[model samples]
Target: MIPKINGLGRSFAGVAAYCLHDAPTPDERSPETSERVAWTDTRNLATIRAERAARLMAATAKAAPDLKRLAGGSRGGRKLAKPVLHYSLSWARDETPDRREMSRAVDGSLEALGLDGHEALVVAHEDTRHPHVHVVANRVDPETGKAATLGNSKLRLSRWAEGYEREQGRIRCEERVKNNERRRAGQELVRTPWERPRHWARVRRERMVPGRARRARGPRDEERVDMEAWRRVEAEAWETVADGRWRSLRHLETRAREEWVELHRRQEEMRQRLDRESRTVLGRLRIWRTERSLRELAGAIRGRQDLVEGWREDLDGYHRDERAELGKAHGERAREIERGWHKFYRSRLVEAERRAWAVRETMKERQETRERERGPSIIIPIPRPRQPRGPERGGGGFER
Candidate 1:
């Protein structure tokens, strides 16, 4: 299970609307695609949003007598900038915990983040291959009106998830376990590039618009590029450079090829390692089986056929589990390779498109510069005879 605590937003309505309706904007509303509300502290989404908004407003109101009830009251009297917590818990693609389990996970996450008993909405979405739920919680406690502390929230969630996974008998994330160990030993936790806040923010800025992180992985229809505009730009650039001379994109092609080759080499190395491990395991298993068979034969000669059968059964089960584990590992590796290739090609395509755009801009600029240097064509104005005075029309007679 992977838990992601998204941005702290300011609007409870906005976050609630997003989770309940699955629509960022009113125009994009699709009730059919909206996930069902699995659990909520309030009666309905609208009511919850309104109640939370009211509570927050009252708590933060300038006219309010008791400023101590406001969020962040102890932190030098600063109001909470963002009080809405948008979080998500997603399971592996093949693992779909039922509604009860999902509810428990959501509850545990909220408690871990110090938002237990806070007004929250849990929506379970089944639109994707993986089972995930979106949690929109108000950080301000309705009763105390104090915003929940967010200190070490990420680490807290990670620890909670580790424990939850252990209880569930599945420890799929070794990195989480290692990080927890490091934390206990007073060592700095190792984080990936995307895990760093600054790097994540930069990537989000480059790849998506502000406040649109949810749709960054897959752009919405309206967020997509206008093909007609792109076509016009391409055509104009091509027309300006119609001399049959084109900028070579061989560098991009070569880089892509080299990367692909490197990927293949890595995959081959992994495959070879897997094969060697498989052979070693099989050899050991075979030797053990031979020894077991010899013992079984001796036992059978001593009229201990039942003991021999039990040993054979145990051997068979052990071999079956081992083979199954190896098969699962091989399949996972294959999937990883496939995903790597997909990402590699997609990134190369993006880079090529960017390069092509730069070339087009350069060509357009050159064409414009050439036109400017040629100077404007002179226009000689030809004088036309006046219409013989407009006396017969509406004029005051012919001009002197």
Candidate 2:
């Protein structure tokens, strides 16, 4: 099935245009485009120029979005512009025309075209080609957004085509050719290329033509002449039809080639798209990684700051404790010095009193000895007590 691309994004605007019933992702590039739009029946051998292809695709997209599905295959719910489907059929290679061979070719082409639906409607009838059939279907769908649909179906188109050929001087050879015919006598037979391939031109031919008479009369002079004339007309018509058929086949071959080119273009685009998307994702990832790394670095820095702040606070506390202990020790040393001074002063005062008492006792003893000899009232002239000496400067005995 043709992979869908609904609305164009990126470089996809007109690239997804045409889709054959057997077409792969009509909107996408074919294997021929990039070794990726697979060719089912025939290998896509050539490529169309990029510019031309883009233009044709643009036209197709504009004409119809669901062109591929409208042609036949069921494409679910995706609303797309119908793509224009143009095709013509010819022999595979070195093949020619015969009734049986022609029928088989036509049948094969129909199958190859892959008519899952569509191809049923026809307004006229045509018949042509003795051993081959030529089909022309305009890819335009009116009822839907798809290209033209063939509404009348196979049996209907085939019969109509036979009638169409008869009108064009090319006779219908199919067994069931009357169904789509205008049967009324007054009604004129319409020769349309939709059913049969024919060349329309004004030419004078004898009544003895193949189409002029369906059955031949008995063997007689008049019958013989008419038969001969009829044979001649049939020959001429075949030549004209053959020429026309050849041209049409060539045209179809060209269209097929164009389609191959279109497929190739899309394939290349697909590869590019995939590459582009991958690169975009990588770029975004790189940016995200860089940003994440920056964020982590910032967080680590903030944590370190907190640790330093705590250390600073601890150091201040330690200094304050040291100062308090040192101050206490200093006060204790001052008190000990005061105590030592007070003790030294008290000892000096006590020593002075003891010396004074000893002096008194010595004096009393002398007086007692004197009394034993004489009266105890001996006048002892103990010089008055000298004053305690202190630090003095030198001074002469005489008043100077």
Tens-digit per-residue lDDT, 146-259, candidate 1: 667786788899999999999989998999899899766545457885443223432242231223311112212312443344445444443433221111122322343354
Top-lDDT structure, candidate number: 1
Best TM-score among the predictions, by candidate number: 1
- lDDT of candidate 2? 0.37
lDDT, candidate 1, at 30: 47
List of clashing residue pairs for candidate 1: none
Residue 397, candidate 1: how far off, in angstroms?
41
Q: Write the per-residue lDDT of candidate 2 for residues 285-378, one digit (tens) a residue.
A: 4433544655434333444444334434554455446544543443343334334433543443343334434444556677787778885565
CA error at residue 371 for candidate 1, angstroms: 29
Per-candidate local distance difference test: 0.59, 0.37
Candidate 1 segments whose C-alpha is farther than 4 A from its true place: 23-76, 191-400
- Candidate 2: which stretches are off by over 4 Å? 1-59, 62-146, 153-156, 168-172, 178-400
